[model samples]
Target chain A: MDTIIIDERIDVGAVFKKNIIKPRWFVWKGRKYAITEVTYTWEDTQGAARVMHFALSDGNTLFEVSLNLTSLEWRLEKSSVV
Target chain B: MTRTILLIDMNAFFASVEQAMNPALRGKPIIVCGRGRTVVTTASYEARVFGVKTGMNLYQAKQACPQVIAVEGDMSRYIDASHNIQRIAREFTDQVEMFSIDECFLDVSKTCRNEVDPQNIARAIKHTIREKLGVTCSIGIGPNKVVAKIASKMQKPDGLIEIREKDIPVLFALMAVQKLQGVGVGRHISEKLMSMGITTAGQLGNTPLEKLMHHFGIMGYRLKRIGEGKDDSPVDSSGGNELIKSVGHSHTFPRDTRDISIIRSYMMMLTEKVGLRLREYGLMGKTVYCTIRFGDFTSWGAQQGLKEHIRQNREIFFVAEQILARAFPLSKAVRLVGLSISDLKPRDTQQFLLKEMEKDTTLAEAVDDINKKYGVFTIKASSVILSEKFGIRPSCGMVSKQALKIKV
Candidate 1:
């Protein structure tokens, strides 16, 4: 997969269940998309900042999203469709 | 009494992980490769069927299978999967030796309970790996590691085989002598053995030891034991599961160059990678080694030991440059340059270096912190800043979960 590093900030809504964080919806580029399923979840560390990377599907498109814990910011790191 | 050993080999590991994570890549011909690299690191079963094999350049792989999809390999994903697999293996036996990123050996002799057969344990391990990891593996159960390793490769994709002592003679009678593990005596010796009418493992095993030793020296004894399906090596699981021998990185230039500046910059970049890994693992080494592969494929390496153990980029690069200079006055253009630090020991106490050393240590810590927070290369030494400009990407070779010791 070609990983395009897009560090632009985006809006994300997540749910905390049983100490697990799941992304429910996200907004990017003035568009709101509801996540249908999360294909994979992984944790990455950047210095002291911990980021949660989620490969989520919005029914038609697959997007890779990252949430920075220290900054509490969400970024769309990559996308599989186009 | 024979001890039970099991070898678990992941099928097309990198490609399989890519397929497992991406639904779009499933069942399609895929080849995992480094960016701008022609060599195929791993090929899916779909691509392999069309004659695409590991180490085949992209041009050759495409020639064999035009529809092959090339994906840049992500070492982190493979490393994570390997850790999960190792955890699964530990559920059966604590004696799990991670052979590589995609293979491991487990000594289940002590853990094989009275009611369950050794084969059953292998089956359970395979089942859990498939269900949890969404990947398949072939497992081989044998009286020892060598036989288990050979049996693991007997079937492709997903296979299970058990090799008993009684099965050795018949199973190896038709097997090529070269198929035996640790028999890589090269083509000349293989040809000599073939000339002696020793083409099969059974023949090699049955050959007189004195004659074999007279022909091949000490290696002949190892060959005989491997041919007889005997391996006395134990599965080592000390040091939190993975035993790391060395931390190093090597980059092959797209075009062979003789420019000293370019080569030095590449060396600096590699030393940074090695140093980062060393500090990450809380390890330090006394020896600095450098390797240079010329355009003719002939390689030369040199190493030097330091009185003080080091895990900093500047120190590693300084020592590596010294070693490289010792092998200098290049006879030809350099194709690849690699740096590694061996003779490793855990970092314990620091020696006082007065002002300069303390300043360097503080700077290194700050830089490491920033890079670890942002991403690698977010902050790098000025000497290595041109590494990306020169297309000197960090090499990802056989990443093991044990290598990445993430501190939680």
Candidate 2:
């Protein structure tokens, strides 16, 4: 599978319950993807900012998304077709 | 009571994590490595079937498995997964020793006394791990760490084997001497044992202690007992999990360079990172060591003693910089730079008597607070600007350097 890099900012729909941030759906390129499952999550450093990466599956596709906790921004890092 | 140690070794940890995250890669060949690194850090079982292996250069891995997909390793992902696995293992026994990021030894001796069967425990642990984490482990159960480690290798991917006390003689009779990994029977030691006509574990155990002692000195006595599949080493519950003997950081350059300025810049950056961690751990050190590995891979290093223990980044950098310069006048291009501090102790609680020193410490603490709230390196020293321009980022993988050297 070819991973197309998409280091682009996007709006995300998330639920904040009991201090847990869970993404329910995200709109990218005007297409809303309903996340079927959150497969994995991990964090890494980006300069001075802490980056939280989420591997989310949309039924048939896997998308890599990141949140910049410092700037409170969301990004679509890359995506692969399953 | 005989102890029962279970060695739970994950199967192709990094690659399995990758497969679990991306269903597309499931049941397919994959190799995990850094983006720029040419060597493969891990190869999935699918790739292993085609002769792909860890430490193989990318080209060689490609040759072995043309369809092998290369995935960049994310240290955070693997570390988090390892922690989760440890949590799961603790559900069965509290005496869990993390042998490595992908392996651990569980001392279920007490659990067994409660009439719990070791095999059932292993099976339950394996099932929970697969169901919850989507990864598998091979578990070896035995009377000691040595036999348990060897037993774990009998089956792979998802395997469990128990080596009972009664089975020792027959099982070890034909077993090669080198298979006893916990005893440190490397090529050097095993070759000597083979030369002495001790080809199998049984013969090694049968060898007279005096003769073995004369050949191997004090190590011979321990080797003979290990040959009989015996080891008394406990599965330490804490296992020095919180111990930070020394704080250090190292970076391998993209290309070897003889530029002194670039070398010092990197040293300063690494030193700052080390100091940040030392402060985080509330540690102070009185010794600094600098190491440089030339392009040829030969290494040179020297340690300097500090007049007083300190956690300030600049103070450690000056010592580390001087150590690096002492090797200088540049005999060769340097490929790697490493900085470490030893003689560590907790920072004193007393306030600094001098106003200047007090101000500096307070300022550093404030910077740390901001960085902790915002991000790392948010208030980095100006000396690291060159490194930043060179795209030297604070990486997650730096912790793995300290993690790998831990003894099982």
Off by over 4 Å in 2: A1-8, A14-22, A42-52, A59-61, A67-73, A80-82, B208-218, B239-243, B254-259, B293-298, B327-335, B393-408
DockQ of 1: 0.44
Model 1 CA deviation exceeding 4 Å by range: A1-7, A19-21, A48-50, A69-72, B181-192, B239-245, B252-259, B277-286, B293-300, B304-312, B325-335, B343-379, B390-395, B404-408
For candidate 1, lDDT tens digit of each residue in B87-155? Answer: 898888788888877888999888765556988898899999988878999998888888998889888
Candidate 2 per-residue lDDT, tens place, B1-408, comes to: 789899998999999999998878899999987645566889999999999989797899999988899887767678767777778888998888877788888999998998889999999999998998888999999999888888899898799999999999999899988776545677889988888888999888889999989999999889888888788888977755556778888877656789888888889889878887788789999999888888777999899998899898878888887788799898999878899998999998798789999887888788877877766677888877776665462353355434432232
Best-fitting candidate, scored by DockQ? 1
Q: lDDT score, residue B46, model 2?
A: 97
TM-score, candidate 2, is 0.87
Lowest summed-lDDT stretch of 10 residues in model 2 chain B?
A: B399-408
DockQ, cand. 2: 0.42
Q: How close is candidate 1 to the true structure, as a TM-score?
A: 0.86
